[model samples]
Target: MSAVMITRKVRKWEKLPGKNTFCCDGRVMMARQKGVFYLTLFLIVGTCSLFFAFECPYLAVHLSPTIPVFAIVLFLFVLAMLLRTSFSDPGVLPRALQEEATFIEMEIEAANGNVPAGQRPPPRIRNVQINNQIVKLKYCYTCKIFRPPRASHCSICDNCVDRFDHHCPWVGNCVGKRNYRYFYLFTLSLSLLTIYIFTFDIVHVVMRSVDNGFLNTLKETPGTVLEVLVCFFTLWSVVGLTGFHTYLLSLNQTTNEDIKGSWSGKNRVQNPYSHKNIIKNCCEVLCGPTYPSVLDRRGLTQEDLPVPVASAAPSSSSSSSSPVPQTTHAVLCLQKTKAPLIPNKRTPDDAKPSIAASAQKSPSPKEENPPAPKAPPLASPEMDVETSINKDKTH
Candidate 1:
């Protein structure tokens, strides 16, 4: 049989089997499923446009020339921060290679002392000390590696993310170690921007209302009413999230850990990752060195090197699951089960062997006074069947 076909497909981003969406040759990455992210973009752009066109021009003239300048700065900064949060990598850990996976399996085997074949395996959690505090790392079946500290498998992205905070659909990406700073700053800047737009919209109306009357001001600038409505509804959630993240930042806890009560629970557990000082915690999270993206999305994958996935011993890990088998093996069990068996061809001349065997087994009557019955010598099942067929033919 021919060997399994090895196809080379480009795009390291799409080459990954993880459940993520990649764009711009992996420049832009996001969860496969995004919620309200477009709505967020739409609301920000629409509200800003209305402010610039209707509110900003009037405010720039009467209120202050800096009003439009400051608003533009806020608008541009908010966009830059939002894109940084949404499009950037979220500190995803690459799936373990075969060598790494084998090494880990060996370590597991040494610790577990070999679980007998066909028996239930032990739980895949391992405990290690960090800052003198014990942290249990759970094995990810998908990634085929025990996650590092503060790493968790994101169900949405189907990738293990380091310092996983939460999968924010609003950002269409995971809030993780790499981009959490951007997300936090996005929220912070956005709250200020929202408040700024809201405040100025009212100010514009009041300044106009002094001469034109409040009801007339509302009617004249319809965009002001719309902007106020958008900002008013958006203000609480944006400000609320900013405050919440600020609190979380001070404690140096992730949204994931916070929700799970990792530190705040009645278990009296302390957060080992926390510096204990608020300023230090904030500085560590906000001003810490940024981690480079793990996705080599733009790299070219030469597929044939890794394509001989078929091995004598099949791996149960997800990465090697359903691997195409190789042609050579100690056993052809897979081939035997899957390929149709060839049938043996028989001719009428083939019956001669059975007749000859019967003749050899039956002694001539002339050679003995009485024909003696003799036991047959040991023979294979095929020989026995031939003898039976020969006897039936003679009878």
Candidate 2:
């Protein structure tokens, strides 16, 4: 059937003998590693800028004091833009999501009325309260078991992902358990770099204000004006971006979720990915040891699981729509029924009657004759009666 295969309760990070690493070969790790390359570029630009602006007076005549700052800012902005692009189109990876199971339940529905003895029904997703907050859970259809919070099926990767974040093209990987914090850090640092450069150049330009006289004197200042243009552009971008990320951080959202339109009224309370403590969560996701691992995961128990008893068959308290073990919702489904096909018969209204007979039967409208007009009255004495009588006599 080309159905995927899965190993239950086995995590993504567990080490088997002779394996080199316990990780998805996805780009999240690689892109995060590449961020260092950008950092190095920033440093090199900073050195050059400093030498031109301060150390070398000869170059200072051509470059502004904030040139180094401008360079750093420009580099950061380009890096951020590239990263954003990368995040937008992440490639595929080979991995499976994992979660802990605390309870078990099973239900079955016949496929084409051919029942398999003791075969479990398909898994359903559910919502549950964890540590006083609601998080979603799901069943892994391939594994025939329920999965825990933050688990997802990666179609490209062809398996469920634990703590699943969206795939990013910039990192060329899925932003899940591990590289989430690094993603945030990359955005923040880029924003700061842009703002710093913008502020410095703006101040410098204003200080060097020239008299217009009869011509625009600002053009007299020498060399490439790219620095000024770059500064203004970065200023607008950084200010807007910083404001946006601050809000997302407060609400604990990813760029991927923001664009994917996943937020709901219940997101604040029901979101499993929100930081338990904003600061602590950021630390864990960014630079801490808390990346999502298939191994060492936890999940919900069976006693609290909600089983959707069929309304038609209420005595079967655990119906085919029972929630998966670690998840919080039922996998709702419609029962399939096949009815015998019957050919449609034409009614009197639908039948084609004689068109000529219908046309001849229609009533015709009757025509009425018009009445003749009355003659005009003769000319009176109050008018020019003599002239009227003369004219009538001539006629």
Candidate 3:
């Protein structure tokens, strides 16, 4: 009878070691650390609540009724964009499976003359031409593959993301190929919403101040005052972020690429991804076909299932009769070892001591060990007797 292997049936998300939090049984996902994101949510919700409570009523009653409706519409849009940016997959490139990783390693070795594992490895990089220009793709140790062009590893997420822009704590998610558009839209709408609320609050104040003096108007509705104060401080940062991302969007460049100056003047590089036309760039990024999430997080995994003994075992006469070895998953682990301190080849100075030690251990042909000195011939028994007699006479 053949031995059997029993294992748990689990979802893919259950097995991943990523630093992400999943909810709704793997339907929702986000970074595990969300202190900043919680703060962001509080600020947005609180500010909107204050606006709807204190300012919207006065503006709707005094001015056109549509003022409140417009604000509501814009507010919902902003919230939707924010949530989309936060929850959607940010173009994560899944780590290579065992078979794929092994194949890549073999290809790298073969291309680089099969360098010895104990010796220095060849640079894990490959160059590919894109849009009539060359770009270097680097190997990611964590992903165990040459990173796709523009893709980078996020230390925070502990995952390699395709066309990575940046990790945004504000959204509690990464901005990358998948969600960059949503992130940009969120920032843009958030800044606009702040400005809209701030401007109307002032108008509401002015309208009331005409009937009552300015100081008296401030004293009557203090929530309006507080809303203005909150919006005042938050306005600049959100506006600035929006402006910067607009520039990036027009150029078809990521925040990561911009910060690194990848396609900048001194580097003498050009962005291959750029359409070289503003409208095209905007349309391509915003309206491009969306890709499905590569990580099948919700999918079930079945592995290492044992075969029935009768089916698995062959005839006793057959030497090849054997069930497939029990399977095990291979996980890519982070390295803790430091690089070598010295070069592989030894220098003359380094070799001198070894050479001297070798010389001392081995004798020269001319300095072979000499034979032991011969002992003086022993006296015969008669000579010994004569010597004994002479000794007696002398005594």
Candidate 4:
């Protein structure tokens, strides 16, 4: 197929309102809701942490004066990372680039004899084996393009993200190629903050118990009790998340890939992008150029590259007949035709007549006889006798 034909097909399939116009009604609402949720979490955590840091008598009397300042700095870092992750772009594919890719794919398909001239086939999933592991790449019918490796369509974001990790409600955004480093940093910082708070609370409570008694300290500082409980629970979650991401960084895998068992084969010794250096992998994920590095490794440069689009595997049938071409008229015809309803057994009188039978059985309106005209009513008996007398006198 020609490039023009392919472009027309892609445009026809997408049917978007305008070029690069994303419907913002639902997306805007979700973004606002997430913003509110993040703000609420920040306020709650910050207020509680600061309140305990300043008001707790144990800290005021025994802890170093710089502890509160350190706590404040950590809190600010957490907020900064959260904000950065939430607002940064998550490597959305450009509309122009996507169209170019579609055209290239069409040309490749034509060269391979998969699609005939001036016709487009329905997108199919292609299974590729890399590093002894099967990776299933899918074409996005909505976007009219094949998804890149390590990329996924986020239903929440309503876009395909490059190197997608997961949509985190806490951060209110996807942890993807652009912001993954910030996300990791945020997790790590939050974990450390939680650990620090938990330790400080425990130490303060112990000090109070030593000064007074265990039971008296509990009674005197009830706020400390609530703070300690909160820190203990939050510590577990943050620490667990930090540890999981650390492991993923070491393996150079995304959470999405890990969960989907993308690297679960026994023969898999290394990742496709692995330089066989753990330090290099970590640096690439944490400090190196984000989207460009990944795209470069996959041979998809900033400018379009001549990548071969793999055709779908042929069916097992030995027949060599050319495939039928799909047209708009055929699709409309299929939609116009309704499915036949099941026939039910019925009594002779209850049976409904078929269309042909009804046409033959019923009389035409013109052929049927019309009703007779009605006669006028007679006069009352006394009025009739009076009328007769008057008629005789007149005669």
Top candidate by lDDT = 1
RMSD to true structure for each model, in Å: 19.5, 28.4, 26.8, 21.8
lDDT of 2 by residue, 1-395 (tens): 13333434443223221111222422222233345545445543553354345323432355554556555565656566545434322221232324222233323233224447898544465678866765557666554455555556554444444556665433444555554555556656665665554454544455455334322424643321444565456557556765776666666675546655555554433445566577855554555665333333123222322444434546456575565653333222111222222222232443334433443454223212454575896555656767888899999
Error of 4 at 162 (Å): 0.7
Clash pairs, model 1 backbone: none
Candidate 2: segments with Cα more than 4 A from true spot: 1-123, 126-129, 132-134, 139-148, 153-161, 170-172, 207-224, 234-238, 255-263, 266-287, 290-395
After superposition of all CA atoms, the RMSD between model 2 and the true structure is 28.4
Quickly count the clashes in candidate 2. Answer: 20
lDDT of 4 by residue, 17-63 (tens): 22222223212112323765566476547645654554444475676
lDDT of 3 by residue, 1-395 (tens): 67577676878887766687877777777887788988999988888888899888888888888988988888999999988988888988888899999999888878889666689877899999998999999999888988999999999999899999999999998889889989988999999899999999899899999999999999998988998999999999999999999998899999999999999969678899999999999999999999899888899987566655654445774645554443411121112222223222245677767666665666455455785676987666877898999999999
TM-scores of all candidate predictions against the true structure:
0.73, 0.42, 0.73, 0.58
List runs of model 1 lying over 4 Å from the truth.
1-9, 114-121, 304-395
What order do candidates take by TM-score, descending? 3, 1, 4, 2
lDDT of 4: 0.66
Q: Considering TM-score, which of the candidate structures 3 and 4 is the better prediction for this target? A: 3
User: Which scores better on lDDT, 2 or 4?
Assistant: 4
How well does candidate 1 score on lDDT at residue 267? 86
Give the better candidate number (2 or 3) by lDDT.
Answer: 3
